[model samples]
Target: MPRTESPRRGRRPGDSGTREAILDAARARFSTAGFRDATVRAIAGDAGVDPALVMHYFGSKQALFVAAMEFPLDPAEVVPRLVAPGVDGLGERLVRFLLGVIDELGDANPMLALVRSAVGHPEAARMMREFLGEAILDRVASAIDTDRPRLRADLCASQIVGILVARQILELPELAAADRETLIGVYGRTIQGYLTGPLESS
Candidate 1:
């Protein structure tokens, strides 16, 4: 008899395809069910793999989310750099940096995905809140040498998130049509106020 070869079976344990599949599944699950509700088993099922595989590849649900979402920029590194130059013109730098990110990423922006999902899902909203509070807001707050740094950070977040929602999510005509520099100048002033100016009723 001639030699015979057995057919290859399922994907190997360390297959890159397997990893990508899990990531794709995770993105869909997180988008649809939100982070808190999207279980590892469900995501693994979506990817046609075992939940153990998902855990093996991603380490944890939060890590899986961070990987799946894929931010265009890392806030931990970028925020520190932005704040390292001190608070002077920090508002403009911040707005400019954000606009640059949005413009560069365009439709592929993960922030857009986050804001969109957060609108209808409370779980997603909590995810966004925690992410912003910890990653971006807290860093900015700590950098400021002023009273109520947390309040200032939160105020800046409100403005920034509002712009994202208006321009990207709601597609407001005015914001959508406005050029980047124009929006930067307008929003930067307000954000500058929040970051350093007086918060009193005087």
Candidate 2:
């Protein structure tokens, strides 16, 4: 008999496993190339799929990121409460809420991993920035009364991102070993100052 390839031997050239394959390829490409450098066509080529398929599934790079890094709480739902009307203790509330979110996930949380990825991967970083801006900061800015609330929200994010990176990602003992209440107390004050305090004149 003539040599013949098996039916499933080579994924049929144009396979429907394209989405999963694209993601796998994307994960690798994004990790190695970073976000800005990783193109959709490149990812699709790696997965042996058509570029159109990649666009069809992911819609856009931003949407693909949101899907890849879906967090537990919707910022839409959480920020309103955090930035509620007449909220005087914004710092404490933010600290409590953020730490509580981390603690609630125990060991299964994806944040640490995502942070690690973002640290080493530029594509992941872009994805994270988009999610943070659209999901968390924008909502908080809308809910608060602070002058330049968007800037304030960015400041708040800087504090939390630093904490998460140091404690969770780098595992710095000084920060990671601190008790929850102590950490919350300190972080709360910082967040409160950012939220309601005077902004330095630039």
Candidate 3:
């Protein structure tokens, strides 16, 4: 059996011993082997649990990744929330959701970790790109009725990501000091334009 480590970090809302163990294992693997290199079986092995248990608890690799990253949104549920509202003012909803996550999750916010990791670790940056680009943006873009779903998604993704950097990483006083509602409204409109607005040639 592989060595089992105590929960050095992570809180899964209602994390049990086994579940937290799995998360700890996943976090280690992701940090070391990265998102693509890490495998479910390996993570299970590290956790000293059966592969089935990982699936039972987290459902999929992406779900496990999100959880392991300590991100507030549960991949299992966020899509339904984002999908149901359709493309009507999605910018607002998306912005609201991302900001809400940061506000509520606070220091536990994974984006902060992602920024730190991405600075020195190419693997971590790759993982963040794939997770945000594919899991988050691509998934949302696929639902759009526009011609360039990918483009729209990319625009929205960049905007939200920029907000995260400004607010969390740089800690820019203007953005950091801005009222939540006002920031949300301003950013929301830009995000909305990306989702539903017409494109212009530059």
Could you list the CA RMSD of all candidates, in the order they appear?
6.4, 5.6, 4.9
Can you give the TM-score per candidate against the true fold? 0.71, 0.65, 0.80
Candidate 2's TM-score: 0.65
Q: Name the top TM-score candidate.
A: 3
Candidate ranking (lDDT, best to worst): 1, 3, 2
Name the regions of candidate 2 deviating beyond 4 angstroms. 1-70
- lDDT by residue (168-201, candidate 2, tens digit) is 7678987888999999898999988887889987
lDDT of 1 by residue, 173-194 (tens): 9899999999899999999999
- Candidate 1 positional error at 67, Å: 1.9
Residue lDDT tens for model 3, 87-157: 88778887787788889878877778787788678887877776776577778887799789988988887
Stretches of model 3 off by over 4 angstroms after superposition: 1-21
Q: Give Cα distance to truth, residue 162, candidate 1, Å.
A: 1.0
**Residue 161 lDDT in model 2?**
86
Clashes by residue pair, model 3: none
